[model samples]
Target: MSERVLIPRNRGFLFLDSHPAGCERLVTDMWQACPGSADMPEGDGPVALIIGSSAGYGLAATLAGLKRAGIRGIMVSFEKAPTERRTGTAGWYRTAATADIARAAGRDLVFLNGDAFSDTMKNQVADLIEQRFGGRLDYLIYSVAAPRRTDPATGTTYASVLKPIGRANRTKTLVFDGEGVPEVREVETGPAEGDDVEQTVAVMGGTDWERWIDQLVGRGLLADGFATAALSYIGSPLTAAIYRQGTIGTAKAHLEATARSLNERLGRTVGGRAVTSVNGAAVTQSSTAIPGIALYTGLLRGVLGEDLVPPVHQLAALWDQLTGAAPSDLDDEGRIRLDTWELTDDVQAAVAERWEAATTDSIADLADLAWFRSEVQRLYGFSVPGIDYAAAVATDIPWPDHTA
Candidate 1:
């Protein structure tokens, strides 16, 4: 392998490249940030699988499961591999770093790279479970985020849209030029046209999750007492027009409905269950691309301050819930409400006030804009504090030991 210096460059709001050492630093930082499972009443024989276990909440949940639960784990994600001319995805580096840490610690972990929405990927994971997990899985997490999905039955590709449902959406948003300061502007988006909501649901919703469950059940891959969680987000009213009550929200509603249906079916058939873990907002690849989400999350961080529950912490707590340490804080809809901190009366009042008064000059004061930008870069392994960007490091880190 050849070594090269990684200089971070921003293409629009996304990073053009990722640093391997920086990604390793980030994984190490997350390992330290997560709560240890020393006091928890943990159950044994946990063979866990995270469907989108390379970045964002999936990666966080994977870390929580590994460090706290010490379970045999399998990860599934789709990311481009690195070539001689360019670095691969941040997820590729993150997964490589995760595998490195797991190996050093003697942890049981596996990684598979492929389109998770496809039946082929499901079959491959089933085969892995049979070969590596004694033919049964105890825990499953559905946390995939994608721009589009091709239906296996019909081979129709559906692309998700982030538009409002009923009326035009006009909201305050930020545009980063990768310079000294960001420009805050008003963005107007039209409502979802014909088939937009359906397409969004097909890409971002829970049909794939249900399909995974059905396929695993059909193969007898899920163990008795199996539990699965699908991560969901119902954003604040600040971005509600474009998020919670919009096309994406419609898709999330479908996801919640699928969870309810799957929960009942799993309970009836295998004495198992499924639930949607409604998590707090954080800087993730999926959330950063949404128009108004940047402004909303910045204000959320500003108002909540130290009180804000980071996504990894929320996921670690979810692990505690799944492993019998704590009971779930479920809502009337039977969904685990991990977003209570973000939805509190005081927090919302402050965030709304900040949102209303925000402008190009005042937005930074109203929200942690610098931190938000840093976080976005950190996701792609660029803005990590300790990594030496000037030093040359190997970019072609091989994928973890697993079938791709």
Candidate 2:
């Protein structure tokens, strides 16, 4: 096994082997909170399909569906397999670990590894639903985060940009040195160009989500009263210039618009509904890639205190919304605001105050950078409790038979 090393100053961790015990602990927590858990609502869970289900919110939703909602899951993701040089992406290990646990409990889970944006992957999932889950899925969860997307028809690839929409915004960005010491630097991001908005939208917007729904409907893979949700995020005003009002935000707006259209169409056609879910920020592989988000997350978590919800807890809240245990609290645009707690007036106010006062010297005291760093490591199956990090393990574990 390759040696596991932590990047300096809390950037992240690197290793070739996943901690089996860590994976088990993570999934076990998810399972214990699942539908059958004492706190969950009782009912027969729906048959569900999730795109981008290997990591982040998608993984949480998948686990919530299986454990809390008691549903059979069909998960799709684009992830690397284990190779001689490195272990597979954390999602690969997570899926494998979760599958073993689910099967032991007599649950059904299917993981399809490939590009979810392609027609080929969509068709494969449709077929799998028919073959394995008796032809219909009750829930479709779209939680993919990609930097670029290839158009299925024209084969043109569009990449997403993370620039502000107007003039450049310079702000104090934080980074950890190789030794784990925090340093603050002023980072400037320029405005988006003429085609940047369009390109970003084309890559990250709801176009593919709509296509997936349309194809599934056309193929009769959706059950009556089916529901679909795609994840989005709206940050606080502190980072609005770069995040909420930026190029990616334009794409998110398009996504919400598509959700509105799909909701009406699905309601009219199949008595189903579709909605966009605005989720709270958390540490994930995707979010870590976005500039300024890490600092924002740390500040937000510090302000929110223990009330902050992680991805798993957020998915639990979503399950509550879907199962009618909790109210949907639909916005005027017909979207669901799962970030309700995070966006509370008190929380934003506190974060805003810290945002203004934050500096290299003050950040460590004002924000939860410790928590942020630990979570980043956790995402990669590192720094987890109960794992013998020194143990020798194989990098190339075979995919479960169902996934294979």
**Which numbered prediction scores highest in lDDT against the true structure?**
1
On residues 1-404, what C-alpha lDDT tens digit does candidate 1 reach at each position?
Answer: 87999887877667778888898899888877988842322443389999999999999998888776776668999998889888989999999888877666566789999999999999988998999778989999999989999999899999999999889989888787756478789989998999999999999988999999989999999888899999999978888888889988988999999999999999998898899999998989899888888888888988877777877899988988887779988999999988998898888899899988999988878898778888888998988998888999998988897643
Query: In model 1, where is the ten-residue run with the lowest total lDDT?
Result: 37-46
| Segments in model 2 whose C-alpha atoms lie over 4 Å from true places | 1-24, 33-44
Angstrom error at residue 152, model 1? 0.9
Weakest 10 consecutive residues of candidate 2 by summed lDDT? 5-14
Per-residue CA lDDT of model 2 for 177-199, tens digit only, reads 77778776789999999899999
- At residue 102, candidate 2 shows an lDDT of 62
TM-score (all chains, Cα) for each model? 0.96, 0.92
Estimate every model's Cα lDDT from 0 to 1. Answer: 0.87, 0.80
